[model samples]
Target: MVNRVEVFAAIRRDARVEGMSIRALAEKHGVHRRTVRQALEGAEPPPRKTPVRMSPRLAPFKSAIDEMLTCDLDAPRKQRHTARRVHVRLIEEHAATNLSYSTVRDYVRVRRAQIDLAAGRRNEVMVPQEHAPAAEAEVDFGEVYVILAGVKTKCRMFTFRLSYSGKAIHRVYATEGQEAFLEGHIDAFNEIGGIPTRHIRYDNLTSAVSKVVVARGHDPARDRVENSRWLLFRSHYGFDAFYCQPGIAGAHEKGGVEGEVGRFRRTHLVPMPVVDSLDELNEKIREWDLADERRRINDRIRTVADDFAQERQLLAPVPVEGFEPGLILTPRVDRSSLITVRMARYSVPARFIHRRVRVSLRASEVVVFDPDKSGRTQIARHPRVVTKGGQCVDLDHYLEVLKGKPGALPGSTALAQARASGVFTAAHEAFWANARRRLGDADGTRELIDVLLLHRHLPAAAVEAGLTAAISVGATSADVVALEARLHLAKTDAIAVVEHAGAVGGAGSGRHLVAQRHLDEQQDVARDVVAEARRRKVVSLTERLLLDPAAVIAGLPPDTRPLPSVEKYDQLLRLRTGTDNHPAPPTEQARPARPALSVEETP
Candidate 1:
């Protein structure tokens, strides 16, 4: 076949040459006579005609439509008049006579070409080389369905793409909360190796805008404006945000990211990815994303990885403190002497347990601080365990307090039950007993003592108040005795008070007041001591049985047992030794029983 460019060139040449017969040239060129005649005539081609009008009904409003197109060609397509709108405007505003709606519509259709030609604006070409590298980035989120731990879950996939480099990053998250949004940026920034100089473009995602800024201030006029409050996050992260006009127009600004999201889902997150855990799946996806850095782009000589390396040099360095995306709340200690943080329990030293403390929360940890202290001591730290209503101090911290305060052990049924369950050790019991000795038996004192016990886990300063309170309440040996008597169905307030005061104050206060107020308490303890000693004096068979029944029955053994008559045993031993001061000879020592052995076993 002859080339079309060559054929067109021949036709032009033949026309330029003077007078060869046009018909002969046509036959020689294997062209039609009419085509040769037209080429020779050098006539301007008649303008291409439009197809015949489908509807004559739109003819009357042709002039109005033409005027609208010419005046507001650049206006949004939605704002331009449709056939129905033109019909309405003609009847209402123009007050035109005898203009039916169908006639206006048909007229507009017939004049469509003329109207469009009049409306057309000149187009400008944007040279690609004029744009600099890292000028802008497009960001968006896509939805990805992933099987995590055998459960299908939907995740928001964050995508970011550099306009010039076409380098991109895709990340998946369970939610698009603020933390996740910020995290996605951090990841994308790292993947790109730097941030784009131009502001990021995005659709009006809720993460970016709380409310669309339709207007501002009182008696406001409606206009598109940046939502200032929502812009703070972008400012904090050191990025300018260019929000697209709400919906589809904005979507075009981030078209690169849209394509990247789809590509990532298909390449890295698709075909029903299954894994033992979500973490593992994410790890695999991250590896794939990193690997994409090495893949060469279609038109670019450098790989995405190489472009990202350059971008890294251009990006702002992350602060040494790094980004903290979780909400931080400051809560005072409740009257229960506990601070609630993230629905988990933690103990402050007894003193600050009832006072206000500051709570610092991060995504993973919650720290309670004693702001009153000069150094801002961390009174408690706990894993964040968000609950439905509110957080509780850790029960384990409270348990440690119980373990520290032996006296408080009696007040906590839970502690006592736990001890009874054989979970507590003998050493723990011993320690608790020692604490009870130091603190009095009063409920407040006991509670304080328990608080003091928390010092074992926290700081001693925390429980100082509990210790002082316990001591201030006449929690002496005498008070303990009074409490014991009361436990055994003895009620004597006067005696109890006197005994406690005396015990706490010591003999410096004299015994007279104590005797009058706590005579019964003192007498009871004395009686108990005497009774115990008397019981020890009256030895039962059970106590004596292990002492050797045969020896006791016959008479105490002279050598192997304690002598029933000490003087008699001493005299005999002395007589045998023939020296009152000398010890018995080694041969006189008692022999143990001999072992029986078989002949082969006997060496």
Candidate 2:
């Protein structure tokens, strides 16, 4: 193997303004040909190792710590004790050490038994026995790269693994926001078929934690807890929650889910899982988690799924319907009577503009439930915007209000921009007409109305400029029209040419053209006849045929009556025949004719 130093040295020696063969350099330096070539190609040499020394202050405790760690090779990792804890113990009890904590920790870590504990592995192991009733589940978030909707979207998967059964539930979401966090819990509980007995465990995530206590001389107990607020919400669904210390490294009580979260990400979400959509991807993740629950453990009698099944009965029953998780906020409507929720704007009636509205937001949608308690009416609904740190407002809602106020049009920047951009079609003119009717003489209404035109162009920007110019010069609509004509004349020239060529001869050049002109003149008469026939056909087929069959039958007595003698039948059939043979015996002749009724003559 060629060392980096040798390869780099060879390239430098050969580079002295005179090139040398990389292969020859490799032979001379005793480095691999590829290494020499890479060096010559401007690759940096590998970094040199720097020697680090143990902190001398803690040298004395190193050996003792190492021995203790090795002695407890089979003990649980939490029981083995870290060097920092050991050093603290030494100072507190033995009163013995000039030793620094770092030196002792490094020595013990290196010399400790390499025994692989099941708990230490990233993979989760099944609990050896059935969990006690009411044991809480620990929840956490893990990040994994997944392909969603054809883009490599970074998604955070929420993991909730039971402390007793080792059963893990997972869901992937676009964010780790509060909605995702709370919704994940609800879904996981539903999958487990019950809520945990007493409380659910969680790290000091912002969703649950309001404060972190770091008092000296005392173990941190996540205090200032807002359990009431959470419980107020959760109480509706039924679940108790407990939080772990903010930054503790203890694993005896809280490490189960930490390892499980990592295991799920690596085993199920890594190396690129492709899905058609986020929902599909989440469904795949859920299936994988459920499948994981079915695997048997080496030391456990039942699988994770089986253990969870046993614990299900002990869990609290969920509410009749689950509580929807969301962030609640209040926002005031703007002068436009529009409230901006989740970046997309929605509007109340103009009467309510500037009034405060309550918004109930969810993961996928923003529901503007009726603010007044009169009834269960929804003011508006908009798709939830998930893009971080931005506001999304639906401009269409305000457009509806603007439709009622035509006078507000001129000042509407949106409408002005639209007009300049050529977005105003004939439909926009009709909308403008309607708006003007609704909002006569109201300047504010006009301004709002102009906003509708912001995205349209009818009068091109140049035309608008010309109109504005005319208006500035105190020109009326007639004056503006005259100015437009003058501008059009000034920018364009009329062309004239004399045509002496006689008409050409073709299939339709002479007679066909005259005939076409005649046909066009008679089009109205032809159209009325065709329309009447179509109307009659529709009535006969759909309504009259159904409502009064006898009336239709009376109108067409010949069609409904039994066939007359062969002579009459042949005459009617002749109308359908195309100058060929008489219409063949009605295919019904294949069956015997009904027996002639016995003569009841005179009776």
Candidate 3:
């Protein structure tokens, strides 16, 4: 009730300035004898500390309100009691009507803060955290925009960071789907040469989580369930996983990768790179990644690459088999040699039409295979297009059907694509014009189809070169085109032999002899093919095997017949020597015994 400063000042004035005696000051100040003695001895009086006052009316109520507030720590914020609720409960539960509502309200406010402090609800201050080398890492997806194929498109960068070394791996994807998520992990691990730690941290992404069922007041680990595919992937890589709290609360948990994605994007992907395809964009990204090895992170003397080099030994060795981050689908090939996957059409071989085939769909490519074969035969393959309703056609798949319907060759989609792809080159166009002059349109297109079919077994560039050579030599027949194509191809296909400083006398002589022999054989085959073409004789491919050795060899049946048994020779030896010493061997199947006759009886 009294100000300590003012009281001290009064003691000083009365004792020093007014010249009051100790007894007089005590009476004037209405103070104790000791207080007056202290005031007279010193210029100022020392203030006393007030004792903590206990409230009699609210003593019992304090415990009750504290009990309620303690549970409120875990209870929903909106469901917790207000001051009015506490006051009403006090009167009803403890018969505390004598206590005023304002007294309880004011007391409850201060008490709540004290209880919260006791319950670990104080304001936080962050301290530097140290990570164990190769013991932990973080994973996250960051969104970035770049000009892809001249179109500004949104993309996601899947980033993985080793917390201790500050080394990170990043891969860009069109979507952050589960396949991309798992594939990124595989690729990142491979780039690092091993898997970092056993535990990887994530931010409750749907790719890894099936559902986050619990909101508040529940443990995060118990509330969320891991996706089955994701679990299998983790098991395959032999790694444990941890999830961060939802939203911004968990941002600090995986802060390493969080900062890495932004830093990498700003440093490398800033100028909005324009690339024709994802492969091109990835190639640029790869170059930047390799070049980034020279830069250091923060004040560290060692570069990121240097730290990664040290950390590589601490990481777990990769598994024997790598995981295929792809979705398997069984799609039926359509009549047009096309199969629709994710609403996009990809062409397969026409022979597989109406048959179900297996498709391996990755982030940027689709590979189709014949299901009956154990992945030995790949029917068709195409780069995946991000946009729906896109179609990728391979002209070779339609060659056989085009051969029968040569009239459809001009207006067909396959022809247009072939022309654009340079598969149907200028040489082919020139040859076609010449063929049309010699033969009619129907016959000319058939010859073109024959040249196109050569592409199936040989490279298109070699075929185009052969067409150029054939056109130069004034050869209009398809057999001449085939012969010229083979000649150009043998030289192109020959393996390059590098000459060392000290070489043998004839290192490449064998290769030169092989090429000359191939040329002579091709010339003979060409003469036979031309003779067959010039005449009107209708010959099936099987009948003309004498012309093409490769077709003949391929058409030959397997030599599955059994060889004569050694028992027959044994019997001949016994009969010639007239010695019955060796016993006849038992046979697997029953046969009738032949009647014996003397050699001279018939004569």
Ranking by TM-score: 3, 2, 1
In candidate 2 the C-alpha lDDT for residue 406 amounts to 48
Best by lDDT: 3
TM-score of every model versus the real structure: 0.44, 0.45, 0.63
Top candidate by TM-score: 3
lDDT of 1 by residue, 379-425 (tens): 77754443334343433345445545645545564455445544343
Instruction: Estimate every model's Cα lDDT from 0 to 1.
Output: 0.59, 0.62, 0.79
lDDT of 3 by residue, 315-433 (tens): 99889887878788998987888899888998888899899999988877888888888974888888876678978888888878888887887888877877876667788899898
Q: Write the per-residue lDDT of candidate 2 for residues 1-603, one digit (tens) a residue.
A: 666665586577776455777677777777788777667766577556799874666655555665566557567656877767777876876565575666656666665534334336334453544447547788888888877657787878888888778888888776787777777887887888777877777777777776777678877765645644466667776777777755554344567788887777778766899885567877787779878988864587888878877777788887777676767667888886667765566555455577766677765456765567642466766555556543434333456555566444457654554554455444445433433444344543443344333333333443444334433433323234334433433232211000111112123455578765554445544445444433531112224555788887787646566765677667777777755476467577686787666678434
Ranking by lDDT: 3, 2, 1
- Model 3 residue 588 CA deviation (Å) reads 52
Clash count, one per candidate: 21, 34, 0
- Assess candidate 3 and give its lDDT: 0.79
RMSD of 2: 25.2
